[model samples]
Target: MEAGEHQAVQLCLESGALISTQQHDLSTPVHLACAQGAMDIVRLMFSRQPDQRGASMNATDKEGRTVILLAAARGAWKTVTALLRLDADLSVKDNLRRNLLHHIVLSGGLLDDFHGEINERLKDFGDLLNERDIQGCTAMHYASRNGQLKTIESLLHFGAIVNLKNNENQSPLHFAARYGRYNTVRHLLESKKGHLIINEMDGEGKTPLHIASQNGHTRVVHLLLVKGALLHRDHKGRTPLHYAVTNGFTHTMEQLLAVHSHLLDQSDRDGNTALHLAAMHNKANTASLLLSLSCKISHNEQDFTPIDYALHYKHSEVAMVMVTHPSRSEEVMSCRTKRYTCLVEGLTAVMPEVMMVKHSFQALQNTEGVGDIVPETDQPLPVMNIMVRYGREELLSHPLCVKYLETKWNSYGMYFHMLNLAVYTVFLSFLTTNAVQLMAEKTDRENFTQVTSAQLASAFVYPSTRAKYFLDIMNVLEWTLYISAGLMAAGHLSTAVVDRSNQYIMAALAVFLAWFNYLLYLQRFNRIGLYVVMFLEILSTLLKVMFVFSVLIIAFGLSFHILLAKIDMNVKTPVFDPFTGNVTMRSMNMSDKGFHNPVISLVRVGTMMLGELDFLGTYLRPMRALESSAWYQIVAATWFLVVFIVLMPILLMNLLIGLAVGDIETVRRNAQLKRLTMQVELHTDLERKLPRRILTMVDKTEVYVYPNQKGSSSYVSVPDTKHVFRVHSSYVLRD
Candidate 1:
């Protein structure tokens, strides 16, 4: 029942199972085998049949397609051959009235044996190639539609008609050209009897060239044009150029325009030219090409020109192109400006002021000098709260616009320098303080030192209050710095005790001081802070991958540890010391820390993941000492080197790098907005600190002072004589 199960079919037939059993699709074992191209199963099943005319061999499925017809349609040459040897029906038709030849042609007959076998069967039926289906499509029609060159040649050799038309009145060339089959079109054109149907029209009155041009088949269009296919109009009175322009096929339009330049002005049933169609569809390149060929811009039946069509569809770029052509017709230019001036007025933010108000008022000379005279109208240019922000290059190149230099605000005053100095001084002081203490500890052992007194005192005074503010990372860091400063003070104050605990406390204090100072420095660059935040966001994903990687390492490390546990050899290991000489000790492995235990193996593998592969000596020394298990240890070490070193670290590390690189641009764009947010916060803080009198004196400033009344209905404050600088409202563009 399954595909390629010839043995199962043989076993069932030899055991005398029913040959006429049907599946849910109403297909028998023969139909199923033929569909799968199971030639052996087909032969086995047909050989067990009771007779040639039995119900199973010549049975039609639900769709009325028999076994051999299904095989022929699927191009199953072996299955078709096996059925033909058993005398299968060759003249049966399906629900679509398609015989064996029709199915072969429709399936393209790509296989040689399949097409040849079907063609040999058709020779006994006498001119089945020209026989009509239900839709009146012959085998040649299907061959042409599917671009089956071999099938076409076979049908032609069998005396198939070349100029047969389907029910849609479309010739083989129409179907070939419409589907962009360049080779099939060429083969049809090269045929002696098929060359005359080049311009034959279908039901829609579209020629092969029209269909090819509409589909944007450049090579087929060129070939059709070279073969004398004309650019005739269809039922809608639209030429091939109209179709090309509407579809934005610039190359096809170029080829057609070279021969038929007058088709540029040809109008359709609605009196819309090719330019109108292109503009309405927002085909800027096609519209520009039409304008370059001097296509006339005229109105449609509704008195709408191409520019109006573009504006009606909100295609501003296309409208701008149509309005700026250098060689545009005088009639088009004269009528376009007044008709679509609303579009130019809508671009007030992007266009220059001179062009925006050019036609509104003319210059008049008063008693003083020439100036703009105001004109009265019922509806002035609507106030634009939102406008298109065109780039500088686009505004500079507009024909009716003149560019003006915009004044830019630069933050280079004393306030900017003071903010920078504050951040830099704090960062440098933290580093300098740590360095000075380190030098004093090394050079002067008798004297004690504390870096800063204020930091030392605040550390012991604010432990409880600082613990309450741990949710804020900055607060937590500040408290950590304070506590670390207190710990360092304690260490220096207790130097006389000379305890080892003091050394450990000093080490932890050093780490906290360095981390707190680094965070302080990062807060200064708000833009870089955004990059840090983005990197932190992907930390969870990296940790998850590391979790999986660790699981794998742990599994493999335990395996290697258990396998190489008893293979260690005692050797002398040297210990490096400053006060004493290098001492040697007898150890079972490198550093007396043999990886015979799983925990030690895991630690070694963890270091190897960070590209520390010095454990090769640990594995090699054990192999050299134990000659019995030397080969197994070498294999285990090699596997460790391959998987943990090459596979995990290199490949997974690169994957993380790729993920970080992909998010870099997104982080950079967001950093700009974050920088602006920081600037707004800094400016607000500065405003709150300044005196009210000085804040009132600032230009483009707004002030809202609530009245000091209690339970009064009218609590709005009015400007009194004492605070005389109050204004209603003003706008300030943040620097």
Candidate 2:
């Protein structure tokens, strides 16, 4: 029967089952059976479920021990054999580095090296032989400790490191010697490689000889000594003789002394002899045996002798023997520093990447684009986050290549410029209209006071002021228009540079410039200029909102006609009609009918009439013809209505409003000055007259006077007279 309850174990096993009938702990039925050392149970479970036996044979148990290791530790050779056959990893170690080999070595089983059955069944003996346990010891160390010669030989033949050390720094040879395993020690020595046994020490800095001496193993000590083991000092500067005597190993001490009696008197690096250490350790018999070797005490170096050390440690009996002999003392040195220099270097090495990451984070916080985050490091997570946050494909394609293109079109000064222009334009328009009105009023004989009004208006004219206002308005308008045009052009250019197309942008800029010119014309033209102003205004508005191409065609036609007529007439084509064989009848017929042609035909008539008529008649005939034309009558009526009715009213209203605003501003300024003067007078009266009157009343009319000694005249005096004389009589002033 297994040690654990079968029902509880069965429930635990079932509760922990996973996929493929595997358990929660990565185990199977065979693992649990082998671990618990139940052979019959393992066979029964294997027979019931053959597939479960092969599930993760390398899986570890709850303690991180493999089932193979557990079976090895329990000496369940059959179970261990079964697990190894199932491909359980023999080299797998627990958390403590205790592999199956370590368990088997510690199990105290008698292993046979020459057994063919054992060798055939255990093919992994070589794997176990080379495996190291926790504290860096191998199975050979454990085998050597238990005096298992055959196991030691098997491990050695299969490449088990005989020189391997444990946590205590003791080799397998040291373990064998310390445990008095003579046969195992002989086997290790026989199979030892170069530098394997020499200079090997334990945790206490003791060679194998020291361990053999401390454990009272005379034969092992003799064996190590014969093999040329050094009688070296440990960390405490104590030799093997010291350890042997201190641990009460009289026979081991005798063996060491027989080899070298002078070794007892010899002091270690600390000037402490073997006798001193023995006396300190309170080994009376070992100390006496050392004292029989003619050991002497030196008085000068006897302070805090072994006797004193033993006495301080409450070993009084040992203290008596230590006081008989002592050795010299020595001093050791220490060196250390407080400043941390490496930290500064480490920070310097990482500074660039750190700064890049910080700047990237700050840039991302302010902007909206995913590609805004720059590539700073090769780390995948940060780059992946950037890609995911900002669409990866979009960022890669058409990356923010034109990030530096200028977007700012205008400055604060540009707006100020516009304001100045509007103000000056309005002011100049007002001045021009007022000047004309003044001249018209002066010419009207029926109007009374016309001269006086003219003089008054002239006095207030101030052409310099008018000019200043006009210049200011022009300055503002000119700069505002220029800046707006320039900005629109630049914006279009920048957009074109970024997008590689300027069609819409150029059209928009052209329209903007045309509109600006329209506004300028509106400001320049008043009543009489309206017909021309309206034409330009309508054309510009059409160009901006509707058909730019149509406007361009009209402009092109007019320019072409004007240019063609400006060419010299000396170089002429045939005047005669080729078909009729006479002078072109169409021109002669138009002249006979007296129907004047348009400007183009008029230009041709002027060319023919230039020498025929005098300059005066030529100009008069053209003028008369133009005046008598039907088109001229229609244009004249339209111009008259637009200029006199529509545009004149608007101009008149603007002039009246400007005059009214000026008058109101003048009145406001005068009132403000008047109020300031009154306030100053009131303050002066309160500061001087009121204070003097109140002081006189408080003094009750009493007066004080001071006389100048040289002139015998009173320079200061208070009023004593009841009546005061006036500079002039009030009646005389009224008359």
lDDT of 2 by residue, 514-619 (tens): 3454454343222223333344434444445324333423432343233222222121223666797886422211232111333444333333222221323223
Q: How far is 55's C-alpha from truth in model 2 (Å)?
A: 2.5
RMSD of each: 17.0, 39.6
For residues 1-735, write the lDDT of model 1, one tens digit per residue. Answer: 775677777788888877678778788887877888987666677677666336777788888889888888887867777777667777788898888888876765643555455456666544566678888888877787788888777667667777788888878888889888898888888887656889888888899999988889888999998988877789998899888888899999999888777888999989999998998899988988888887776778888888677656667556555555556633444554335464344333333221212211111101122112212221111011001112232322221111010000012212442454454345335534553554455422222243454344333331333233568565576666655544554555556643435645664665556554554445324344555545554565577777877777787677656656555566555666767766656566433444567799888667666777765465656666666656576667667666766665788678767766767766554443333333333333344444557544542212222222223221111113233221111111011
Residue 482 deviation, candidate 1, in Å? 26
User: Model 1: C-alpha RMSD to truth?
Assistant: 17.0
lDDT for position 704 in model 1 = 26
**lDDT for each of the candidates?**
0.61, 0.49
Q: Candidate 1: global Cα-lDDT?
A: 0.61
TM-score of each: 0.53, 0.39
